[model samples]
Target: RRLKKKHFVIECDPLVHEGFESTARHVEIPYLPMLVPPTKWKGYDKGGHLFLPSYVMRTHGVKDQKEAIKSVPRKQLRKVFEALDILGGTKWRVNRRVHDVVETIWSRGGGIAGLVDKGNIPLPEQPETEDPDEIQKWKWSVKKTKKANRELHAERCDTELKLSVARKMREEDGFYYPHNLDFRGRAYPMHPHLSHLGSDLCRGVLEYAEGRPLGKSGLRWLKIHLANKYGGGIEKLSHESKLTFVEDHLPDIFDSAANPVDGNCWWINAEDPFQCLAACMDLSNALESSSPHGAVSHLPIHQDGSCNGLQHYAALGRDYMGAAAVNLVPGEKPADIYSEIAARVLDVVREDSMKDPATDPSVPLAKVLVDEVSLLPAPLCLNQEIFFFMYLFFNKTVEDLDIGSLQVDRKLVKQTVMTSVYGVTFIGARQQIMKRLQEKGHITDDKLLYDVSCYATRVTLDALGQMFQSARAIMAWLGDCAKMIASKNQPVRWTSPVGLPVVQPYKKYKNYMIRTSLQCLALRREGDAIATQRQKAAFPPNFVHSLDSSHMMMTAITCKEAGLHFAGVHDSFWVHACDVDKMNQILREQFVELYSMPILENLLEEFQTLFPTVEFPPCPAQGNFDVREVLTSTYFFN
Candidate 1:
């Protein structure tokens, strides 16, 4: 038995066989092979532990920045370091634009290094740093990089804030500075962007500013013109200096002042476009001695510069014309407000909310002004229940109950809503309102903080961090969705519905799909990474937006059929004030035509083809469509 046990427990031995190739006597030879080994994956170091592969970093949002920086060839790396030596380490105020890109990238660590390392682009030459101060400057440069980055973000916020305040002051208090006005005597040197970017859409009656208390409530010091008398973009002034305008007794003068005509000759002002148009009607009425067709209507749509317009790009229709987008939202804040309002006005009774909100009568009254004097049309008033937004769009809480459909929930409506239903222009002001509401200790909830947190997302957080950094768990869940969808394919590339190819950030480095990042699928936490996959989930909405742009572009082309000179910023259009009625008519018609197309179905069909085997979640609320529901709301575009 012992012998048998020993035999069974025998030691394992390797079976090795060696074969020798017969030497060929006279071989027509191939070239001699070099001593290079086979290619292997280049992995990058991340936060400690095992290094992450560049594929994982690119395919996921987790940037292996250290490895990325190291991946740069030594020659290029030295150039970037040299550029930083010139810029005081990280000061954005640079004398030469040549070194800006490289110095900026170097300061931030990695991102653009691959661009230079590949010899795709050479770093612009800047004056060499030879000063004794250069040594100490660069030593602290990397240390101060984080702070400098923060300052850059702060500077962006300041720009937005200044633009907001300038829009308000321009509307509320016209600076007599002659330089501010452009060739047509309109506000010149405006930011390339539009006004009230963070506010809700300015949907209101165009006829009356009579009883409208007409301005943001607490911009206390904007009653006077700029003290310098050199009217330029608000960026020209310091933050402290910009806020010190005289606020007592100036709104009337500002209103009475000549409104500037923009490039399109549209009347730019603080009032909603609808309100301005009505005001133009009154002005035309006053100017015309003769009645046309005896309609008893007169208002000259001439130049006036008091109003501030939005650069909005909302698409609601179906086909080329987007006819089905019965409800349209232009800017971000406006979209949020109108989305809430739509939830209310379109609300319907439900057994566990089974009824479609679109069935309610309040829908028509939702965005339309009750009368000319009203400031807001009818934005949904928040109560303790709906006090906070669930997210930027389509997020909802259980407290957002069915009473909104009843239209009789005035008791549920809070007093924060003013009698005049004007749109919110400054998101900061809007946040202040929310904070004030929270302080009252009535409806305060975590959603308010979450909503506040989302503001950072709007300002553009780090490309990789955006997914994991969502304030709400749902956003993270959505990030997971993005991951799943994006993981199915490598060398992933998709074009917008209108043809703008979705460029990968990896392209920013190598200018090509390196396939280096797709190996992320092999990672242990393959399910968790989403930074790179955000575009996947965003595809549907982004495609719709592209269609919106397409529809608008075609609409601009089509509008020529009616002798109109039209210019649009996405969903919103600007024309001479006199053309307001005509523009609205054409816009409504064009929207109807666009919606008439089967845009949503087409998009879904494309989605199904791309994600054939993979089971995706049910269609999101943003993409769910009902042309019947849309056809009834003329105020949708407004």
Candidate 2:
């Protein structure tokens, strides 16, 4: 009663089968998901409009809407949410010409050229060695070479992906990237690549979708923006002086605009080459117009902070000297903190070198020829034979230290000074200096470079401590508070000025194995015990970051209400050239308003209320600097 079924088996030729099997063996299998979709699940009302409360609740992943509303006060949430929406809604388009240039550079692997210039040498061939020590050294070299190559490849892939997406978006009228906040309430574009957050090439290839007439003020600002990108001694000049510098370079700018790759390549030498090139093009277009003031422009002029973290610290402590150093108050020229630190470090080195080695126990001594040679005391153990030869050839004597031979400049000490507020360790500072020294192609000897980096790091930190005494006191107080809370097995928690709750997530974690169909997976479970050291060390920087975010959010909201197109990258703010003045006024106003509140006092009060049993130190006393002075301080945001 059952029907018979027929089966067919098909076989290919033996040669074909062999070829297919070989190809299959060489192909890589992707075990993980290759691509992720953008998050677009925003909350909408019955009329399909964005609902602030609903969106916040969904983003925070709170099932109870009422509870979410209670955590973030409704009024504060609305302001932040609206600001984010405004930021996301601003449309952008790619500069087709610049995009093409970027594509050409990427095709030739130009992205990794800087790494090569920084002493990332080519991979070496494997050596046939029987000695175990030699083999071990060769293995280390191979590993380092592989790492550099992998990094270079990764950078290339990232650039290509960005360019591909940009090419696709260029055909459309315009594209908008949605924005969201981190745990600390810092807003960022949700889309990873091809956003304003990328490098100089990315910024150069992007412009506002909408264009406004470049009136007289806008044109002046455009020229200043160009000069700013060029970045040299001219950067510290006043606005009028900057404009004059641009005027003087009119011929070079035009040449760069007309022939980016072939001409003199004047823009190529700028601090931000691609952006500077874009500015040159914008300037050319404006000038070629019969009515230069009436030319349409879409560039966003930037006003960056001068070491913004230190600025906030200075503001919080009301330290006038610190404020002036960071350019939070008025100055004839914009203060250069890095250069000032470099000068202080140089003075310290010279003073130390001038001490008589025989008389002063602190002074370091080294024997050298008496032919008027300036010698830096070597910190290494030199061979006795070499010392004896030097003494025999020339009388042993100490000479003036040739400070000029040492390359201690603003660039050398910039990173150390910048990260000092973030609690960079001594080892970390030394490593930063070492990399800078290597890039400069001075001190090729590994041991000598290490010694110099160690010395420089010490003086750099000492200089920072001396310069920002109030900042140090505040940092110590913050660390102490975190230590106290973390010692009690609780994470430090606080509410930002904008009412966003921030919790330190650093805690001890335990690993567990989970059995899956394919294999066993190890996952980490966050434990109750706090990571006391990390919690203590990270609090100062994290707290400062949250405060800066609050300042930015306040500025964003105010700028939006004032009907100005606005964008921000942490401390740096941007608006159209025409709206720069208005945006500056609003930013200054919001800054003063944000700091007017008793920030540290409120934080201490919150901690006291949250942990009644834990006794905490009182807030540091405020200094005499006036917050209102920022309003008239032209260089505050420059």
Candidate 3:
């Protein structure tokens, strides 16, 4: 009955049997055992049962799934392989595929219901002495939340669109087929994700951008410029030219013979014993010596569609790019860092646009957007940051990360800085029909003024008759996100862009509920606490991730082209202090290019095709969101 050897952590729940207590020990099971315990297995202390370590594949020298499984959990290995065969082929990494298999199994009655039905666990009895009215209210909330989740899932998924893209990508590149677990068109981080593979305009424009950094230009200017460049930048390029310019161009750039090498590559190669000793040794070597750039072997810049809360906008541009990484050389600022980083970012974007990943961009894009945005808690943003602080705390450095002349606030490092975009939160709340925004998030110290640019911005309950304006812009934004999450949870099922199906097993919203009495007493519990929180926080975080990914990607490429050392932690881009100025300049220009295109309109167009039957609202006018307004401060990158 155990379909997977590596089943859910049953010991975590107290609902199981507590008889036959025994001393902690490790034993070899006979049956060509389905699950393999990790290398330093600590036997779980349950009456007499053993809870093996959580599944993990060794990071070193794992060339294939077979090699990977030798170290990772063996239970369900066959199931994972079967699923992968159906999904595609060995185009995915072992770790990621393992994760997918576990999730797939869990999603398909492998968790809550499986435990109760197969494990013979008894559900907690309903409280007999509780007040009836409170129970009914809890029941109603749970019902509504379940409904919302299902609807949101449907809005996010579009399997047909995804499967088509995957097929095409496989035909184009055998080794890499973009697949986000949920099948959103956004390419899995492991591969490239361009616009629809068949569209020349989309691919052509993308190539031009990737190959070079051109300042902001209208479509007309772009066409003319590309035309002047021997028509290589457009769909009209000779088949040979397409091969030479885009596909071949990027690989050439990453090679040592073609491009300059700057600082050493600095990456965490060791585990933190406090940090891993082995990784530290490798990082030490890279920091002291030079490494490759511009290719898959180095800091390969890439671009794809994004879901920066403004999916409508990322769709407009249709690509997110990250450049190469360089190590920080003490006081060694490479000259022209700005131009270098810009050139690298542009090249990567253009190249990736021509590459194309999954056909569907919804889920991959949403995942990227949703994953990062979920990292930000309004409380942390309005106060100080947590992630970057943890970094600084670990490194013991007090100097703020600087880009050219701008210094990033440590608090904003992990969380994207919310500038004028705070206004967007209110606009969204209104659109979603959020009625009492003022009553939502709390104000810090009862003062309605928020800190901004060495001055206080006078935020009120309702600015210009807006319902979502408040003391802290982050808090206001989160209030709306919470509403949106609740709304998304109200459905039974939804599909992702890549054809991954997500069906809710619960009949009510108990899984979406927090650590409240109802959840503690229910037959089911929200397995993924973080995902539940993201549903509550909503779009702002998604937007933040897209924006951050794009920004970092651009910086990575810029540094690669300029031949400067480039590495970063989330929002903080790291390079030799000397290259900071050029980093700023190149990023500014790239920012313009990123926004210059008609993104909002394009997103609407994408939506039209992705969800052909649904009618969407008119695209927001260009004036509605001015990049000039967003780029006014470097805080977003900080």
Candidate 4:
């Protein structure tokens, strides 16, 4: 067993082979071959144990391995060193087997030196130092950029504030200095883009002045004379000087003056557009007309000079108009009457809980009249159009409740529209009179006429409040209603019959047209409504104009029509004018004349072809047929 185990532990040895070419009679290849003897070193050099190849170590017991060295060419040995340089000294190791393999390949066709050259590893470029002054300059530039950004933000904020103040002042006071108006009395120097802008300004002023006291006469005066002054457009005003007459008295005169012709009075008139001279003369005459006792006795001049001074003051009002009087004299004390008025104005603006509150105290003093007047109610009572509209809208709101039909809840409608906040307040104040009338059994619904006036007052106040940014937020709520519907996929119903859908992108085109029309109406361009009517009239005989630029109800109808069309339905309006016979005749003729459908049967056939599931039902030819019922039902269904 010992002998067998020993035999299995036998020695191992590498295989070797040798070959010789047979000598030919005559052949010599022109090639030079050279042998390179391997070189090796072995010793301890900080790294431990050393070993070397046979030719390198040259030990007596080793066989002649010089043949292996002789097999490789001398040129290949240099290539090994070239590869060593690329592989880096740290990773390279010289061994007989590895050297032989490299050498054989290099000698036959390839060289390690070629790979090293191809790598072409480059030395890094040196970094340059920046000059101290240049570094400082860059730092300064960075600081400037930051500062500029802050300044730009500040400027934007200021512009926003200015715009807000300007819009508010425009809506509230209507105090505008016509910049384009030529004091020289000829044509203005510049042509304004918005021709009606001047009219808007004048209207704003008259509206502010009239407030609750506004009458039809006043409104008519504005309509006639608004564009006559200021050359029919918003004119630029020089902001250089202050005018006392304009700031202190123009608003009062506008309110109190009566038209010599028909007692119609407004803020400004074409006859005396810039007549501060005439206004001061009027004030002087009034002062002179008063019994000179209570406060006028200490006058410095006679009543005659007072009147003449009034004229002089009016004529010389340019000095004040062009200077610090627009706000106030620079060094005026807070306790001064002007300063006191300013303070009061600020207090009033702050205390106002209405839509727009004045946040800035530095508003021009001239606008105080507007600020005060806007807090009041309007005068004119609710007319049929406005009352009916609000009634319809409110009535539509309660349609979900069990009722006989979708007829308007007149009581709720009147309560919401006519019995508004101001109306209620007025009613509360006049409770005694109402109670007495009720006890006498003489209190009719007509007693609410006063409430109509109260409602108008509230509406006018609300309209003026819109000039203030805060009051206009009500519009945002109304605006969001559209957005809320748009965010939904289906129609939203407040009441069963009053279904509204969200706005869709496809419907938005027609919606935009309607909105544009309404905006034009609000701007008082009567031609827009007429133009739209003309366009619709071009379509068909039954095309009773359903879209009205001035009627909000009609606009809503248009929106609904567009929405229904997008929802895969078509709707049309034909009041009493389109009776059964007229509609049938029109439909027959429309299809035949327009697209050659001579009879109802022909139209029905075409419709069935278009919509295969549609079915037409038999009906009495004598009875009037509702087109809406037929269109929405299976009358023409295939």
Which candidate has the top score in lDDT? 2
**Candidate 3 C-alpha RMSD relative to the actual structure:** 22.9
Specify the highest-TM-score model's number.
Answer: 2
Model 4 agreement with the true structure over 1-638: per-residue lDDT tens digits: 46652222433221210011111112232211101111221211111112211122112221112232233344433322221111111111112221232233333433121101111123233235487877676676667665664454343333233223333333232221111111111111111211112222211111111111112322222211221222111111111111221334344444434332223333333232322222322333333444312211100000001111111111122222211211112222111121222233333433442333376332322232123332112211112222223323443211122111111111212232222211233344234323432443322465353443333234333422322222123223222332333333211111001111111111111122234522422222222112222222221111101111011122223323332100000112111110222232333222122212112233234334544543434211211222222222111110
- RMSD values for the candidates in order, in angstroms, are 24.9, 11.3, 22.9, 44.3
Give the residue spans of candidate 4 off by over 4 A: 1-194, 197-483, 489-638
Model 3 whole-model lDDT (C-alpha atoms) = 0.28
Clashing pairs for predicted structure model 2, backbone only: none
lDDT against the true structure, each candidate: 0.30, 0.72, 0.28, 0.23
Query: How far off is residue 454 in model 4, in Å?
Result: 25
Question: Which ten contiguous residues of candidate 3 have the minimum total lDDT?
Answer: 321-330
State how far residue 547 of model 4 sits from its true place (Å).
7.9
Q: Give residue 328's lDDT in candidate 4 (0 to 100).
A: 15
Candidate 1 runs further than 4 Å off:
1-484, 489-500, 503-533, 604-632
lDDT tens digits, residue span 456-477, model 1:
2222122112211211222233
lDDT for model 4, on a 0 to 1 scale?
0.23
TM-score ranking, best first: 2, 1, 3, 4
